[model samples]
Target: MRLAPVSLSLVESVLAKPVLDEKGMILVGAGVKLSERMITRLKQLGVSSLYIEDKRTDDIVIVDAVSDETRRSAVNTVYNSMLSMIETERGARRASRPQIGREISRVFQDILADLKANNSGLINLASIFTVDGYLYHHSVNVAILSTALGLAKGYGQKEITEIGVGALLHDIGCTKVPQEILNKPGRYSDLEYELMKKHAEWGYEMLREQDGVSLLSAHIAYQHHERNDGSGYPRGLKGDEIHEYSKIVGMCDVYEALTSKRFHREAFLPHEALEFILGGGTALFDLSLVRLFAKNVAVYPIGMTVKLNTDETAVVVSLNPEYPQRPVVRLLTDEYGRRLDSPYDIDLTKELTMMIVSYNE
Candidate 1:
């Protein structure tokens, strides 16, 4: 399967993967042939890309670090918990429900178990969701990415849970913001930006008051925005003053947000987003954690078509666990832009001189 941008040209293509809703339910099942109407509807839903069945790359598989069941359960849990908070703030409910912290903690335990079962240890967050579900999906993606980073950093189960739970509810304070500001399609005004920055403090206060939520976890919400150079918001604590867990969650938050398509701008490819993160190392984030993230996350996901420095075109077939940035790819076209009759594979780790220059060409 190959990942292609959603357009009218894809009307006849079959879906390689299921399109999921915010609740994790399948809106369109895999192997279904797309029609003009379906494609138009998908575009309306803000689906920028789709995995299309390609005979040449049929063998290439995009594996999620966590299982479908685990991911769905996590998304549903986040959606309900956050929605409940939003309702409470609006006075639609008497008060925010109790046990939110405990509920999220339990869901995260399942996520951890799934991650441990996967031997790859590399993360590929390839799930497709609509723009409206961005908050829930973003929260879940952050938790998954944060959990993977925690494991890579040699954290124990207890420490991993703390970071994972914190990552899950990091943006819970957005529930307190007005819907108009939160859902605005364009950049915020000066005053609106100030209100937006208040989410961190609001989230920290909300989480701290919840049962089963630790003070440390609540602090993750508070300090996730704080930069290592004291350039971030809320408190702007510098260097070691920010908690280690907050730093991890904050880095993951930025990465997830960048890679996700937003109302204001197109999503950055994995490699592009990683480059931005690496460029901000030490100044905006902890250098050590940034390096760890670069090592563990897949910069080029499976099935993505990329142009090589050698002027050839190839599709990433698998990841190099130890060197995720250098994936094994299958050559699809020659340097002269002619399609190969029989494509061959190349392990980028073995061919260190060759590199991917761009993707989705």
Candidate 2:
């Protein structure tokens, strides 16, 4: 399907792609026949829409940064580990350190292999979001982006693995925060905000105590909130005082947050989010990492309908790695809203006079 807003009755014709739960477990999978019962179950879980591989866009594969299995597996591991850390903070017994570390390493390996396999380097995470699975999904996105950045920075495999695992476990301390505070739909008051900022240090201390966990890995949790110009939270360390891994994860962390949907406000479009981050520049993030990040992400993803400045409407057909703002698109209609007899593809990079004006839907 081309991501149309189909009703429940229309849902019967399409298959259910893998739908993940809050804990990152598969709630539904591809090729499964859809039924009224399944649709009802999905609605009960707060899922209002889903991706299907229907004939309309069957050829338009949404290339994943990692496999569905890999992404879900990583999400599940992070969710479970975060919950365990919360339990421990509440007086429960500590779990095996070696086991947790091993799981982190294993996830890193799987993610690393897939990242290398993806030619575009740019990752599209919009394909896998769940309304209630924001925390775990955010973890997976951050890890993916951080790993790609490390790869771009010429980090060795071992170092990249460390960065990946560190980014994955960066928000474990959020589990200790009050659920209401965590899910607050509006800005936090001064006292609530101060408590919220404590998560970074809490996460670092928790990770540092674990056997087999790397000190640098724990530092990622500690220092990810610190900014390049000393404007960030917890310990307000500036510039080189922030660890390299922390800087990378921090940049990814902010980008993910900006692009993600929240109850209080709508999520920014990818290009819009990038512009916001670019505004921060070296003041809020490492400038070099910011530039590299812009390269390795899709501003306008495949399958999105957009209006062009030349008075035409089209669907994004292909991504241009060198020019993310200009992708190959298939013309759907003319400026007068008349259907075309034969829709043709235009490489926006070559057609320099035309530009995307707005999202059609």
Candidate 3:
């Protein structure tokens, strides 16, 4: 059935197996019928065609991109499972459920496959938005990023899965805190901040009790915020004192948090967030891990329109992995921002006079 605003809930309920075709159209689910009103709405919205599950609507479905159901499943599985695990641990009994860990790992693997497939494109940064729901979305993004970094660093699949599981449940301790504290819109009082810091302790206690969970998993919850300079909370371990896995997760967590929007503060753009992290030197995170992340992640991904140093306008077409700060762009318009029938890609770092002035939504 056609959807007006493309509600994810409705999509999951109605479409069992939607697919995207090569042409970028959505395929409808099998054995489902669309109402005429829904069809009208889709047309009004300029969704030219969609691919359906069966051969009947094959022409409509185009690109086999990620489906809303897949996205929702990923979000819910991560969120609800973590909540249950944390709650179980808080009671002082074992909370480690091998099933939960496996589930989280499975979802993470799926997300990583998708991201890697579309690596250089406009990253589906939507996963980082907490606009409506929280916890699950953020966890999924962290898992994907951490896994990506691990993959780029040549870690084996087994180690990546362990790290991915750890990243997903790192914030499970937040479940023990009151909603008022977790969702506080402004700075917390000292008392509240103190309580907040206790999450790490709470998380560690809970994970320690669970069966089949690794030491690294619990350690991540306890150490994600610790800094290399010994300024981090819970423990003041300095320099090489912090575990290597903890250090990697620490950098990933902060990067994800800075890039994510919250009720408290606006999310920084990727470039701005990375700059802040880099500027911190080795004070806030592992310098080597931070540098690796900066190299791999696309700061200004494709499909994002941007302004150039020469006051001209362009759209990113690909990345210069060696120098993430300098990406190749397609000159789509002039300084006046007029459209061009054809665009040419330019390497901004090689072009001495050109820099990215700003990014466009």
Candidate 4:
């Protein structure tokens, strides 16, 4: 299946994957042919892209970082947990641990098992979510990613668990803010920005008192925004002052937020987000953690089309760690604009002169 922008015209092609709502419910099932009415409804609902069956890319299969069941369960667990937190009265902030705590713990365990099993492959991090569906999916992706990076950095099971929990709840403090401020379409004003920035400390205060929640986990919420150079928020601590867990989670947190679509701007693609990280260097994020993230993430995920410096249109078939910017691609059309009779593969690592010029999302 090919991942491409869908419009009202492609009503005849069969859906390669199911279109799901924010709550993990199906909007359109896989193998269902779309109609004009269906396309119009999807567009109205803010669906910009769809996985459509294409004969040219039939053999290409895109793998998720975790299984669909795992992904859905993780999202629901987060949504439910946050919902309960939001519904609580202001004075009762230290109420009993909502059901989401136990539920998300189980979800993290399941994620660890899946990651260990499929550790060999590149992390596929694409998520289907509308702009308003933040926090739930973002939390899940950050958890899985930070855990993977922690493992690659030689962290043990105990350390990884702490990191996973910390990563998942790092943004739990966002619930403390008004939904209007959180979901506003424009950039935050000075006063609104200050209020929004307080989420980290607020989240820390809430989690620190919860049963079964560790000090490190609570601190993750507090310190994930704190930078190595003491340039971060709340209590800015430099170098060793920032915990290793926060370092990992903080790096992943920024990556997920940048790559994720938002109300104000189109998401920076994975490669673009990584480039932003590199530009920051160790001033804003830890250098070691950045290197670990670079090692694990795929810049251009499989099954996405791209254009090369040679002016050929191709689909990413595989990733190469040695050369992330130069992936193995299956050419759709030659430089001369003629479609190939039999599509051929090119390893950009070998074709030293060629590089991906544009991402065709």
Q: Compare candidates 1 and 4 on lDDT and give the better one.
A: 1
Q: Which of the two, 1 or 2, has more TM-score?
A: 1
User: Model 4, stretches more than 4 Å misplaced?
Assistant: 6-10, 36-48, 90-93, 336-338
- 164-184: candidate 4 lDDT, tens digit per residue: 987888899998888889887
Which 10-residue window in model 1 sums to the lowest lDDT? 89-98
Worst 10 residues of 3 by lDDT: 55-64
Q: Please report the TM-score between candidate 1 and the true structure.
A: 0.94
Candidate 4: residue 343 lDDT (0-100) = 92
Distance from true location, Cα of 31 in model 2, Å: 5.1
- Tens digit of per-residue lDDT, candidate 3, span 71-92: 6566777666766776565676
Model 2 alpha-carbon drift over 4 Å, by segment = 1-16, 31-56, 92-96, 336-341
Task: Give lDDT: candidate 4, residue 250.
Answer: 87
Compared to the true structure, candidate 4 yields what TM-score?
Answer: 0.93
lDDT of 1 by residue, 215-330 (tens): 89899999999999999989989999999999999999999999988888889989889999999979999999999899888898888888999899999898887888788999
Models ranked on lDDT = 1, 4, 2, 3
Please say which candidate is ahead in lDDT: 2 or 3: 2
Clashing pairs in 2: 1-54
Better of 1 and 3 by TM-score: 1
Q: Number of the top candidate by TM-score?
A: 1
